[model samples]
Target chain A: MKNFYKIVAVVGLTMTLVPSLLFYFDVIEIGQMKLYMAVGTVLWFSGAIPWLGQKRTQN
Target chain B: MADKSSILKRLDSLYEFDREPVTRNKLQGIGNFLGMYAGEHVAGTEFVIGMLFVAHGVSVRDMFIGGLIGNILAIGSWAFLTAPIAVKVRLSLYWQLKKICGSMLVFIYNIVNALMFCFLAGAMVAVAATAVGIPFGIEMPALSDMLPNSVGWVVTVLGVGTVITAMAILGFDALARFAKVAAPWMFLIFVTAAIAVLPKLGVTPGAGNFWEVARESIWTGVAREGQSQFSFWHVVFFTWLANAAMHLGMSDLTILRYAKKWQYGFSSAVGMFLGHYVAWIASGILYAAANSDAPGVVAYEAIGIAGAICVVIAGWTTANPTLYRAGMALQVASGWSRWKVTLLAGAITTTAAMFPALVMKLLDFVALYGLVLIPMGAVILADFYFIPKLGLQSFYAEKKKIDFNLAAGATWFIMLALALFLNLYFKIELFFLPAPIWILSLGAYLLFSKMYQKNLKLNLT
Candidate 1:
């Protein structure tokens, strides 16, 4: 689960960033870009689940 | 319900070091101030202000030199005025004001302070929502949008507000940490997008004709239709007095109370120089490229989706601390639990986010916020240093068990009225109102206190 969280965090950040860069440089079109970003945002928020759930995490 | 309670529990546990001076051991170094001011000033509002400067028709020379002068004066206010008082007292603005003005007067001030802060943060929430809405196909509000344009806009604001409020509820360290991460990225992005889009605006980097291109196309001294033209003095005053509430008005007593030395207040230069100067210039270029007032869209045009995300995160960094401060003000004023008051303040902010006028009229709104708050700060300053020198008791309310300080109250209203007359009849802009109000209130408070105390013979101490 910890590894899963880590992977989610990394992937979510990349997902959030990659599409934007791709679209800027014209590698991605507007067709599904917004959808991809929506998913990325959700994933990033989910990756922060532990952060939201408890104050016990390492500072 | 379980998640809600957990959130509530988390919020409840977060207590600011209220009521007393922060201990020496707990005092933060200059780096904290550097990071915080940098994060805060180079923020979501930068997008709006940068765009407004362009639309208001400021020339290149006016913006470059004027912003430098204005921001330097702002730094002086923070370093010399606000921080010295903050560190010496080591108390939040609420507690300090209560000691001087008495609880009742401070209560009125708190309500006004919290509402203005909420409205200000609400605009940032709307800015963040613009980005969130982009991917959701939510129609972005125009510069002239006064009402919620669609249900999508409302939901996006709610969504953005939730994240911002939750972070604020986590308290100071968390807020600072978040700023540390976001500030660097946002700064980099601001610079990158500006440079990246310069070519599209017809700046040939090789020919070194960038200044000519900038003068002609980018920072052209021509107002948009229906927009008022602004001059160098206008830009200077706007930049200097934009944060007059925090600096000259003494609201940053809350922030500077955490500093190890008052000199750390000078760290505001980091934010002013980088965000207000460089970032504003960069964003001005971005606006020229995209020809848009919407921050989210302009950023997207410059760097794709990353730009949108920057807008969202930048807004969060700003709105989080603002809403937190508002929540704290209400809590201190109403004697409510911090969590409950924060919840209420957050709700108020989220609702205000539904209206776009808060963002569109931000230049005026910021000015008004500073002007309204400056009088109380002047009163505090006089009570702290001047009254004792004049053979009158300082913290007279605390000594006399008075719930209202008549002198402080009189000083507040008198200055406000004077400000109104100057603004309305004299055609004094909001940016120019703070200076006269600040000077007049200090002298007035001293005179009023001497008379009020002597007449009552309340100087029995």
Candidate 2:
């Protein structure tokens, strides 16, 4: 379960970052970049909240 | 369900080790310190400060080089000055100060410290309010605006302040959790916004004209109308002086006290390089693209709604901890419950948030905050190291059960006077005064302590 959420977080973060990079290279429209970022924000929050809310293995 | 009293007690203990040294078992690792400094530094103020660097006309070369050197000095101060003392003493700044300065003086210091924290938090609230106001068509305050400009502005500020204060009163755990998630995302948002806007600013990745465009349009080295000019030295000093209160003024004693070793102080580099250096540069780029000093306007222009939300969350995260610290300081002075004092702090912060000058003049305000608090840090340093070497008693007030250490009090006041003299008479900028004033504070404290201890010995005999 933790791994699942971790993967979700990774994908969400990648979504957030990649669109901007693509946009910079003229691969994605600004509109699509914003849309991807917005979705990534939601996914990232859902995954990260539960993942980080748990106790850490180390301090 | 737990009753109200139990809940309040739980909330009160959420932040432990206020009046006592952190226990050995509770010592945090370097990872914790790294995450903390990294998260805490990339905050709402970064948006304002980064943009202000552009408005003040800092050339790209000067800002890059000077900021690099300044950040290095800041990290050194934390590692060498603040952390070692914190590791050895393992006491909060307030507790250590009470012993050295005595309870009466600490009480006075607490009031000043708490008020400064309130004003600083108020500025963050104002930044958040700008973002919150955007969708509602509320007019943003001009850079020159000092007073509350509109009913919408007042309403927005109050609304933002209330949410931040309420979250602060709830406890640190929730805020910590939120911050952990928000920090990375917000930092990325800064990166994304800057990158997305670079093309708009005439900077193409492979064009080999990035520096030319940056120098021509971005860090143009020409001040905006009504803004003060800045050079390499100003950039360097401002970068160093921004967090002088934490490193030089020794306020981080409270935070670093949790670390297992002094070396963990070097973890502050993660914050300096990423938040202060990278984040500042990115936001400066966004500012150049947006051509506005208002955080929300610039952010919204760069990346739309995500940018606005970033502004809001960044502001809230920064203001929450600031208000919490303010309440803690006020609790020491007022003898009230943490939540109760936090409520009072929230009121003060909200009121200050109504005034846009607090945010507009944030650079000067931050410098003033450091100047006011740094003398006590000097006293602590001198008492910890130099006073013992000179055969003068250390922590003299605690040793003698004195209500107020006359020497420490005199040093604080005299430094303030010296700061005033330098600023008015010599026209020295506040950003340039901390180093000289810090050295003067050390000497003044030692001289006064010698006189004080001599009188005390005579009275004892």
**Best-performing candidate as measured by TM-score:** 2
Task: Put down candidate 1 lDDT per residue, B404-431, tens digits, no spaces.
Answer: 8999999999899999999889998887
| Predicted complex 2: DockQ | 0.56
Q: lDDT of each model, Cα atoms only?
A: 0.79, 0.87
The regions of model 2 sitting more than 4 angstroms off are A55-59, B1-24
Full-model lDDT, candidate 1? 0.79
lDDT of 2 by residue, B317-380 (tens): 8888789878876775555777998999999999999999998888889889988998998999
Task: Report clash pairs, candidate 1.
Answer: A20-B305
For each candidate, how many residue pairs have backbone atoms clashing (under 3 Å)? 1, 0
Single out the weakest 10-residue window by summed lDDT for candidate 2 chain B.
Answer: B8-17
